[model samples]
Target: MRSLKILLLSSAFNGLTQRAWLDLRQAGHDPSVVLFTDEITVCRQVEASGADLVICPFLKDRVPEQLWNHPQRPVVIIHPGIVGDRGASALDWAITRQVNRWGVTALQAVEEMDAGPIWSTCEFYMPADVRKSELYNGPVSDAAIVCIRDVVEKFATGFVPVPLDYTQPGVIGRLQPNMTQADRTFSWFDCAAFIKRSIDAADGQPGVLASLLGGQYYLYDAHLDSRQGTPGETLAVQDDAVLVAAGDHSLWIGSLKRKAQAGQETFKLPARHVLAEQLAGVPVLDSSIAQQRFNALAYQPIRYRETDHVGELTFEFYNGAMSTEQCQRLVAALRWAKARDTQVLLIKGGRGSFSNGVHLNVIQAAKVPGLEAWANIQAIDDVCQELLTARQLVISGLTGSAGAGGVMLALAADIVLAREGIVLNPHYKTMGLYGSEYWTYSLPRAAGSEVAHKLTEECLPISAVQAMEYAMVQDIGPRCPHTFDLWLSQQAQSALTNPQYRDARARKAMLDIQQIERCREHELAQMQLDMVQNRQQFAEKCRNFVFKRKTCQTPQRLIAPWALTYEAGMPESRMLNG
Candidate 1:
């Protein structure tokens, strides 16, 4: 293949976009990104970018007629649907309608949205129990990458795309209307399965709206329960999640966004916290003794299990945001897991995200936002300390994208293995904080001090492969979740007898505690100024993120120059626009 000059124009540099950018670069092609700000600006950027082709991996904004019709270059749109599928809610409809098969299509940009002729299409069996966000980041993203690679190859070969034909076989998809709030509305009287599907379809965005505790709230992070209870009643509360009865069975809800009242900002929080007053008398189920107690809830966000010589610890927080209490609980879990007889400890994250650092929503919702923010960061630091000073060989398995302090927390482990196609944003400059997770010690040790400085200052998102090159990760695992699990197990079991593991464990034991503590102290001092003093407007950033405010203009850092230089090759930050 030739090294084509490609431009990635996206609404935001999200996970899929970052993956596309990395794949293109790894394939020896020059790729740059231009964030979609407005119609005029997008057109201007596209015209100015000297590229042979342009791809919109996750664009929400429509391409302008001028750029789409330009004869000098070709513009392709990566749609999350199969042939003949047209609409913004393609995946949402697939989940809610319980479609068995779904696909991703790469089509030429035209006047009509998602109605262009298809260049390449790839399909997969739709997963039933997965959340909408997980589906997008997983199967949908995998298929889109396939379509994208195919489109790029076909473009290089001067191949023409097939037009949409209703009579053609496998063309089962059709135009789906944009999913509205009404489409996602579910009553407590609805069956558990129906309610779970409704809520799953709308996860990560506008959640399913329902009445709870005599108030209206948007529900998210749904999980089915086996126990039955009276419809519309709160059954129990555990791990900040509330188990409630539905029409047929019961389900667990992890988070809720209360309906905004006059002059109030609506943001998602732990379900129990949202209804703290209303559910004050509700029983809090003890997960440690759930099996012993009849009718006990079995919800566990942080789970630990042993397999032979490996102790696997999985922490799947909602949207990868760890609240203060959650962090404290995880610290205890880590201590317990470290005491196991296993030779290697594997720390795994959720499918949707590994960890995105402190819970901004929880902090913003607190009575004293700054103090809460301080506490949250401090709590997360303890998690890092546990990993850094672990007695056994520790391996951090990143199955999803991570950012900010989350990346630092992963680095605290002896060996970091990331799933292929995952992105890691290892800087905190975008969030306007110096950041602390003992990053000052771990980052420099993993990656050299010079690269660490460059990464922090540049605020660029690196792909898993790039992370490996910078020594941020020891290896890259498979993209598929099941396959990665197998690979993680094999690797963990092999690490017990590997000389590298023994050497790494010895190095960890010999690490100077005094120096690590000093680094944490210095980092926390800077963090205190950033969080407690609010010197860099972290509160404003948090509010903007929680409110989903759109950026009017692309930051100078994200805008690719007309002349691509070697220094400007890295992918831009995706969370900056958040």
Candidate 2:
């Protein structure tokens, strides 16, 4: 197919949009992203892009008439629904109703929203139990890709889209309302399956509203329990999960989204922490005794799975933030896995996060912010050091995004592999942190001195493809995050069995020894000096960022550098966030 000029418009450059943009670019098409910043700016930006087509992967807003009805282009919207499915809550309805089948539709952008002409459609089977976000990001994302490619390929052949007709036969989908709290209201009188369905529908957002112990909280991250108990009664505490009554059955509450009360900021925290006072009187089951009970599906912070002499360790921290406690736990996990008899080990992070460096939220919440920041950095350094010195072949696999120290820590592995479209922010200047994850040793060694300096000073976000070019990563996996795990396993397993890899291990060990001897201790000592002397400023910045809930905006220097003086009124323009 010939290369076409494509314009992508979305509320944010989220996972779906990133994947579609990268895929289209690799297929020899030019694609540019547009954030709905303002009406006038966006209109001027789109017209300047000279786009032959427009694709909205996960856009919530409708396109304007001037651009949607371009005289020389086509506008397409990739809807997360099946053919004839017209609504915003298609996935939510499927989960709550426990539908066995689901799908995605690619439709032309006409005035009447999803009622527009269908370009392509793809369907997939669904399991009986799954979360709303998990189903959307996994199977739903896969189907959307298939439909998008089909539509794009057909359009390249000069094919016009067919209009939607309700009279047509073999249509199963119908319009549905947006899933709201009213749709998810259930009490102890409901059956176990009913409770689970309600929770699934609101698992990712606007969780089911309920009250316990005279306080109202939104419950999320639910796991079904096989044990039965009386309705509305407290059961037991399993790790961070809280077991609560669900009619005759039970379910584990992994986290709670508390409402703002008494002029306090509303935030989500672990169930155990949020309900500490009330749960103190609840029965606490012994580990061995709890083992005898029916299967309990509580949250697993760290999990290890082995296949063909390769062990994969996955650490799914919430929002990719690694608190000081979380860092220490991951260190212990890495040490235990290293002592095992496996020939190769894979460090797999979460779907939405690998590690975004240290947890700013936890740091700001600490009693002494400076002391907590100091301890957190050291804990992560120990984790990186362990992976750097492991005897087995260590592979750091980033299934999600990584930033700051998180990006440097992943470099500890002998081979760093990332899923396609994964964003990496290797700089820490935004948080007023010089950073201390042994970056001084790992970064320059990986990408050379020139690129390392530029990366830190520029504060630019690099894509997976650019990381490969800069020698910062070994390989890039599937464009779709859903297919990354399978592709990574195939590559790593094959790499382990190669005879040449066995001989290369000796060289790797020697280099590791040399790095420790020359750079590790020296860099860490300097970090201590920098952080200790700048304690007050560091503390204030972190507190401001966390309490104010600020996001990292693209640095103006990156777009209009002071080094270059442009003509007046001709400002340098760029994307919303680099």
Candidate 3:
């Protein structure tokens, strides 16, 4: 295919857009991507881009006719559902309905949204009990790639798309209205899975509402609970969560937001922590304090299981943020797992995200943000240190996206395996922190010095397929999690059967130890110095980013620095907006 300039536009720079950008660029297309910042001026910028095709993947708003009907340009919007499924809540509705199959559709941007002529479509079976974000990022992304590549390839050949036909027997989808809180609402009569599906549908934002604790609150981050209790009662309180009763079973809610009154500002917080005042009489059953007493409420954030001599440690944290306490607990778990008789260690991260490094939310909420940030990184360092110096054969199995310090943590393992469609953001400069977790050591070792420099400095997300080349990902597993887990287990069992397994394990462990020894001291020193003597206001930057208060334009380093200049008498810092 001839190289065509493609401008990738989306609602925001999310996991899906990041994945599409990398895939399109790698396919030899000259792709320029931008977020829809709700700016009218951006339309002029789109025209100025001189792109042959404009691809809008997961757009909240319809593409303007001016841009779509350009003389030589083609505008395609990637819809998250089937051909005729027109709405903003495609994935949310699918998860809520528990449909067996879901898909991505690409169509021309016409007057009617999602009623445009169809370009391409790809279907995927919906996974069991997965969150909306996970479904969107994983299966939806992979299918979108197929749908995207097809449209681009056909467009290059001047192939015209077929218009929508309501009478067509093959067309199955119809309009689905935007799912509201009322639509997702359920009572105590509903089973655990039904309630969970509702929560997962609204996982990322605008959680499902339920009247509880003598008031109304929207719930998020729910887990299946085994223990039974009186229907609609708060049975127990665990670390930052509450086990609330359902009809058939119970659910452990990790996070929620109290419905705001007339003028109150509401924020999503850890469930139990926010409701501490309301649950005054309820027993607090944190893992550290009363693990045995509240064994039913005791949720292990990290757990280890062995089968066929393979020790699999699964760490499924919410949004992949590793708080200081979470990291310390994970370290203890890792140490205990390492002593097990298993020959291979498989580190499985979360369903939504593999990891995104230290908990920015926790750090930002601290009394002293800088000191808290320092302590959290140090805590994670212990977890990574165990990975670096481990004697067992370690392989990081990433079923979901990973970023920043998490990327480096994956690299610390002897081998990294990821599902086909996962994305990776492996840079720290975005947060303005000289990151710990032996990144300076792991990154270069995995991708070499030059690629390492470009990756960190560019601060771009890479697709798993592209990541295989640059990030040195050892293997790309099955696209489906069910098949992926089966295949992964088989591989671990196969490794046990290898007569040379002992020799291989020893060889890899020795090499990693030698590499760590060479740079650990120097890297630690630089990180400490950068943190303690933060002349660049690193903590302030982190705080702003966490709070979504970043207002500065793109730094000069990314674009032409000469185009921006300070006023002669004003400060150089005033040069941010030319």
Candidate 4:
């Protein structure tokens, strides 16, 4: 690839530009970034970047003509909009119009604002049902990366730019300026289309301002219903869903925020509830509402400490929904447990979900930094393996849904105890990633190769009873009668006091055999990599098979014996607390 000089004009406040610059550098281009802000803060940032810093008068219209015509290399301006759409608030306009498809484009900078010739564009489709906040944070941000990657790839290949045809139908659109207060006020007489569009356009960044009986509220997520009722009249209330009347139709206001004396308080209401009856007469709340809002936003992190036991340690794998900070905490806890002499380690999740797997947010956030996210995953894997290899028993108490990485965490346990309603699912294939956390070996051992293969390939949710019947779980204990804490206490006591357990352990020499089996399993995992591309592909194949069988009536297929025996030498039952 031929190296070329590149100048990146961006906002100091924009994270997208920083990410684009990193991508360009990784692609072997000599890229320099300049913040397009009049503030001194932006100047300092540009200077710190060790790039040529030039101060321009206006962000939209004042690109230095000389720099744009630079002879040494091309000057490309990254516009956070799709081809044919230009100017500020382009995204906001698209959202207001409920446009299903939008994108970001990198174009050659020119004298006119947003009038540059497009170099490359990356397009993405927004879900029709998505809220405005979701559209901005999810698809819009992702589209930026997509566009940047395309631009960099084109640059690397010595590709020539094609000029866009302005005369082509549906190929030109002007920009809209930032929204004003008047633009956001909600009108009760507006049509369903207008109301829905208004709600979508107002999203979180520029929220909708609605006058209630006496105070103001911001509508976040809402739907339009044609059912007629008196405007602003309450209909009914269902958990977390609210229905209110518009002029000609009823509007389902799923979530909302009220402007408080201090700030805003997002209150989730029940569906079909009468908004006028419940909140119309009430005066705007002051300090009490503010306290409630604060309390609502505060969330406590789950923390588990290892107790003094040879075989017992606590194992907790983050569900894919976890944030980077949460994953960091989990890794730290695992390291602490590994260093200790816990005999039987119990793996559990606090909520209804054992784990969803690795946090996709972290992955998306790390795209700008390239492989840094994978490095974090590797760290998590190391911590997980430490638990798997511990001399003590590794027990998994799966009380609810365990999907993707969550399933791998349960598989890592020597014994898995699942509640009656617990579900085991592998969901990686649909999202275009592999299953990590050593599930490739751990799964086959727990349920046999046929079941493991089917679980991954079919991507079906296996019930707790089915799991136990298939040997995925050691036992399906008492149904709905006992809570997880109660079950754990009973199991721990049984392991600590049962003389039969001790006697059998001494006679069978299980520990030595378990150590040998774990080694063989690790070796098998190494060998599987030669057959499969990565842990993700192996996981994806397994998930595809499972999803394919979701509607089948036959008993779920299992993995072959060779695959099961490949890791069967590993111990299934060991007393962790003893």
Candidate 5:
């Protein structure tokens, strides 16, 4: 198909939107983004874009009638629902309702949200016990991409879309109301499945509110446990997660957000940290002892296992935001893995997100946010240092999207392998951070000075394919998590016998440790000014992130190309479509 001008309108440049943008651009389409600000601004930007197609991949706001009624341009909404389905809480309701199948629909925008003529649709099996965000990021996103590609193909062929028809087979979806706190609420007295499903349905958004220790709190990031205790009572604490007993079994609550009281602000934090005072008397589950006593299902963010000549160290931090304690724990794990007899070390990140740097919610909730921020950055730097000087050949498996220091942390490995379709944001300007995961050492070393500079200064997200083009990553793996795991294992095993890889490892060991140390110190010094001194208002930005404050307008960098035209008061004479 000939290259077409496309305008992507989204509430935020979220994972799905970023993926869609990257896919379209890589497919040779001219695409630009316009974040939702307000009805007037959105309409104005749509008019000014003059795009041949408008794709709202991840929008929350309604499409303005002005643009939908326009004769020349066609507006498509990538709804995370099947045909005949409509609503904002589609995923949440699906998870809560335990639907066996779910899908994504690409349809024309109309006055009614998610109720329009369907351009294309793709369905997939709904995996059991998946969180709402995970469901969206995994199968739903994949299906949406499939539908999007089909939409583009059909549009190019001038094919007409079919209107929603109830009589059509496989059109079983219906409108679901916006989920409420009451819909998500569940008691500890409820069965483990019920509680887990409820919490999973509300994961990452408006969390499930429940009464705990005489205080109201919102819960998130749950895992099942077999241990038994009094229902509704705290059993134990381990790795900042609290074990709470359910009717049938126990659940490990990884994070909690205290419901804000009058004149108070609250954000999500590790459950143990949020209820430190209340959990002071709770028995702590030692990971080392538990590893020997129980199965591998014990609640722990970081885990290590050796198979043959490969040692895999996996960490699944909540939302991939590592706190000071979490970072310190990972540092210990890296040290342990380095001391193992394994020939290769595979550092696999979580499925949700690899890592997004320090935990902003934890930093914002600290008594001294600056000091906490400083400690968090230093702790992560320690992990990178361990990887930089490791004896074993280090390989990072990025199974999910990562941003800021997280991108650099992965670069610390000898070979960085990123999953296809994962987005990597390698800059820290948005968070008002200089960043200190030894990025100054890792980024330029991996991708050369020019590419590194462009990545950091531009503050834009790059696709995994783009990262490989820039030499930021050594290879790209399959998008499927299971397939990627198998591929990563094969690669790790193969590297053990590859003379070229061994030679690379030898050269990496010969690097001047002094220069790397100096780079780290410089990065830390800059971070100190930003974090401790608040030179760039890191505190404000951190709060804005944790508090979910929306940006007043889309960043100029995102819509930079059209900014000049708008400034000059130029008419929209097919500026982009032409």
Candidate 6:
């Protein structure tokens, strides 16, 4: 490879270009910078760094006529958007379209914006919780850095431009032409797939808009309900959830923005409140009145339906608050079922919830003196190990919300079944408790570390479809009017009679594997102790903070652990007071 001089053109400060220039210089190459902006920032910075500088107009529209004429050995443009999605407001355009994946392309400068052949591309998947600004500020910035590195590597090896493989199928050609004002207007009747795609594309950018109470609101995450209701009628609010009616389906507005007198602010209100307010005086339109409709929908009883299938057992979890005793009872029942040659276990919650998991408030309040906490954790770990090692195919039938411990329990199952509207949340971090019960291993194994980290660390909700995509859920089914009973019947038949069912034999093998690899008694006990101590300290800190009191002085023995765990590398003032 022959080294050559490199020049970069960018309108705004390009972190990639700057970093690449530094890397090139470190590697003994001559690199220069130019700005398309009218300001002298790039020129001054380039001159100060002993590099050449050039001024040009914007690179997107005038690149062919104006900017590409530069004589630099290899003139490169760092496109902030994905290669196929290059254009002005590329990031904005992508967000408006709800694209799940995006990339940055380092291409040779051509007359048209982003028309040059690609040198290299780096891509990243967008998370649902990531805001529009974050996509540009984080992933987009990271993309620029990647492009810069590619450009620098190309310059080191003698600049050879490679054209984009347009002949390849699925290569998006041509930029998105600017949209008219009319084209930007929001439409509620769009097909579910299109709406979902558009929402994902626009994620963390801008462009998705909806009219709510005469104010324009940017739509973030939304769900389509096939159940029809009056268009624009408010349905119900459950805490921060807002339900609204659309043409063909009801739209559950998980989050919303309203214009405040001061400025635009987002509100996290329940869908029920919005629904009641909007439809207060209107005649109840649906065949089922909202009260009866909602109640009829909320609590549906489930019965255990036995099947002869080797890997299928169908049972329903009753609708009610979760208790530790109930969890223990369920575990015992599963053990009994396992002893009876049950190979496939399907546990579904009644109505709108699978299980809320362990009650956080209860766990927090339980003064599990250090030793007891460890003992409890060990017991929980045993249950988790049993679930993992069960000979039968263990599946969670999730019909409603599964939160925190509930999600972990579902994860313990080999497979999970969910209705489309089920919501899964890991609410541990928010409550300041160190997550335990083997979820640390089970969650990452089920979903990739990146996703698991986001769920555990940020306390984000995972929808059933998203969960399915992440391998968190295996099957998605619709609720039968007779409830999941009929569904269970079919599932049981499939499990008991299916010639291919391997769950019984599989369970024995899994148990043997667990005995060898996931010994539940030893490590789990210690982990539980650690979790309990951490939670106790965390609760103390939170209580102190709430009461405007300082944290209690740490005992000298405890100080060592505190420094090792939470206070390492902190200054004296920031360290725990002893």
Q: What is the C-alpha RMSD of each candidate to the true structure, in Å?
A: 4.3, 5.5, 5.4, 21.3, 2.5, 14.7
Evaluated at residue 431, the lDDT of candidate 6 is 41
- Per-residue alpha-carbon lDDT of candidate 5 for residues 94-149, written as tens digits (9 for 90 to 100): 99989998899999998888888999999999998899888888999999999888
True-structure lDDT of candidate 1:
0.85
- On residues 308-427, what C-alpha lDDT tens digit does candidate 2 reach at each position? 788788777766777776788788878878887998888988655688888776666567766777788888888888888888898889888788889998987877888875778898
lDDT of 6 by residue, 261-338 (tens): 565334322222333465455443221111122222231122243546533333223222343433454566556556
TM-scores for the candidates: 0.93, 0.79, 0.87, 0.42, 0.96, 0.39
Winner on lDDT between 3 and 4 is 3
Q: After superposition, how far is residue 119 of candidate 2 from its true place, in Å?
A: 3.0
| CA displacement after TM-score superposition, residue 545 of candidate 2 (Å) | 8.6
Q: Clashes in each model (backbone N, CA, C under 3 Å)?
A: 0, 0, 0, 49, 0, 38
Model 3 TM-score, all chains together: 0.87
- lDDT score for candidate 5 against the true structure: 0.86
Residue 521 displacement (Å), model 6: 15
Q: Residue 312: error of model 5 in Å?
A: 1.1
The ten-residue window of minimal lDDT in model 4 covers 551-560
Candidates ranked by TM-score, best first? 5, 1, 3, 2, 4, 6
Over the stretch 278-316, how does candidate 4's per-residue lDDT look in tens digits?
Answer: 654433322211122223111212334444563233322
lDDT over C-alpha atoms for residue 253 of model 4: 64
RMSD of 2: 5.5
List runs of model 2 lying over 4 Å from the truth. 189-193, 261-265, 281-298, 305-312, 341-343, 350-353, 360-375, 397-405, 417-436, 443-507, 512-578
Model 6: per-residue Cα lDDT at residue 424: 72
Backbone clashes counted, model 2:
0
**Which regions of candidate 4 fall more than 4 Å away from where they truly are?**
2-75, 124-126, 156-165, 168-170, 177-186, 191-193, 224-228, 235-242, 252-578
**What's the lDDT for candidate 3?**
0.77
Full ranking by lDDT: 5, 1, 3, 2, 4, 6
The lDDT of each candidate is 0.85, 0.73, 0.77, 0.53, 0.86, 0.51
Better of 3 and 5 by lDDT: 5
